[model samples]
Target: MMHEPIKGNPLPSRAQAYKTVAVIGAGSWGTALAATLARAGVSTRIWGRDESVIEEINAHHTSEKFLPDVTLPDNLMGVRELSGALAGAEAALIVVPSRSIRSVARQVAEYAPDGMPVAICAKGIEAETGYLMTQVAEEELGNRPVGCVSGPTFAREAALGHLTAATVAFTFSQADRLKPHESPAVRLAVSLSTESFRAYVSDDLVGVEIGGAVKNVIAIACGMMTGAGFAENTRAALITRGLDELKALAEALGGRRETVTGLSGVGDLTLTCSSTTSRNMALGMQLGQGIPRDNCFDGKPVVVEGEVNAKSVTDLARRLNVDMPICETVRAILHDGKGVGDGFAQLWARPIEAEPRAMDLSFDHPASDKDIATLAERIS
Candidate 1:
């Protein structure tokens, strides 16, 4: 296990200072990641579409909304123009909210050096395109090496250097497509065995991504439980049902079943649900406590992935015949005028069958009754 040595200069010699790692967006999470790279000795350059934020980092070294009180590293530079940040960067990490993925990807493609690896840390689907951020990355940044970063990291916590772990998703068919690069920080690096933080790499990009997108909706349900004063039993049910929906989606796309059980899967979901800090979960709790769903995120000013993804996921589940009971209920509560209590009542009233009926819609089989029965028995 080779660890990055501690000193005035860290990072391996072969691992040249992210020779300018560009991050699009200057929010709390974006700032935290940029700070991480800077601390890792990677001369990180952050792009702020808003000149004021760039000026703030350049002048004050603190973001009032995101990372206040902690001064940003002196090595960190924030550029007002997108091209300035992307011009010579070997790699770029997109940390803009999921809804803004396409716009930022296009900017990078237009501004960055040719074929740079644009790693996407924004986790969500394009509600209009029905495409994950990676899909948008391929379309927007043609020929760019694409990778994804996701896990149970909260912006403030990761910034404070609390231990955390995440899976890095790289796009390519062959295993060699996912190897270590002396430059550009390639290959998925994991700090496993640490109590607080770590990461694991996987080829199951599709499963890991879709689960990351959909889990927010489920996490909101858990938040509703906390806000509504529900018992732990209620919260456990949401987590269990949420995992079922995630595994079903993972199987639908070509992801290894085991992948959904890992960090980007069940691990991420549990973190978001059990805690009140997650914006998405917090949004749901507010809604359950009688706040308008719109008011739940009224002033946040960034796309909450769950706010955009829940409907998209529910639509996908319906078309694919995947029975995502909890997801469907959450969608209804948000959009269909169904009160949280009413939604729970409906879920509890549904005819109780074995749990396998929840996620085994193997799009491979016939949807007919006899075929369904056979598939059900086989899965059971």
Candidate 2:
């Protein structure tokens, strides 16, 4: 039962133009966004590694298996091969899961032409390599104008026409045929609002990228608090204090404190920690509810970005001499089998003092500038 999306949101009168945008991968995030761009009438094409899924989307105009219930426009084209998708595409939105990014990049490098923009949309830390996804992007897609898209966004919400926000930051460029994308695709672009949904791009891509990964670990700790039935005051205290530990690690990794403050950092942290949707939080809750560790993720796509990131962040924290107790606690809970109550108690017994000495950078950068939101949040 697929029908047209009610068409309430005003269509972009910009002649519904997309020179050529190809989305890589056909997972929920990739599929949802492909539908969004197609609905916006962008000359959009999506590349899926799975041949069966590609056939379904191309023939049905709906990605029923992964993103059921959403209707894709007839204009949307699906291809089983990457070379076909990359041909003539102005931009390629890379949406493969974090772990698979490197392999996919190698594939992309084989055919990706020179000077095109690649938007790295999927999130996570590469457990094996420890390099952020963008780092791999650079290695695989050499010198091609690069930008990163991140923030507290889920595939389903953004797909359902819920007002959603994200950040897609890139360096200033000057080249013909690649005249910096005068505007971003309409489905999700950078804009600010104190209410509803908004996204803003930043030049502090490393900082923003690190913040997105590090916060997932703390969200797991917050989930543990929910499982413990701690008071609201306790949860708030955990989040703020956990953020300090997170900030220290972020600075050590060359990420600005302000980047951690915006959507990917504080914003994403709040969304994942406080909500039932977060698999990391949900895992913590189940552990609190006495579910056995082996039984937790059986036959499910339960990915706790923090679970893997805890190790990465912890390693980075130790390397840089930063203190991060909450993160360590999560590691202990998941790996050492330390009781959740013990972990929480250990956190509370620690010392309280004046805000620890932290690095300071000049504030007051124009949000109009790329690094504005990321910098402001860190310097606060």
lDDT of 1 at 60: 87
Clash number by candidate, in order? 6, 5
How do the residues 1-380 of candidate 1 rate in per-residue lDDT, one tens digit apiece?
12233456444432223456888889988898887777666778998767888888889888876787777778889988888888788788888888778887887888878867777888777767677778888899998778788888888887777887788777444333322344232432421113344556665678778779888989988887677777689888889888988998768766767878888888889998988778888887887777776566665564567876789888877767777888888888887877777676556555555678655343322245554445323322
In candidate 2, which residue pairs clash?
A: 257-378, 258-374, 258-377, 258-378, 259-374
Cα lDDT tens digits for candidate 2, 214-264: 778877887777776665786688778877876776677677788788887
RMSD of 2: 11.5
By lDDT, the best candidate is 1
Once fitted onto the true fold, the runs of candidate 2 whose alpha carbons sit more than 4 angstroms away are 1-18, 173-198, 297-301, 356-380
TM-scores, all models, native as reference: 0.84, 0.80
Predicted structure with the largest TM-score when compared to the true one: 1
Candidate 1 regions off by >4 Å?
1-17, 173-197, 294-302, 357-380
lDDT of 1 at 109: 83
Global lDDT of each candidate: 0.74, 0.70
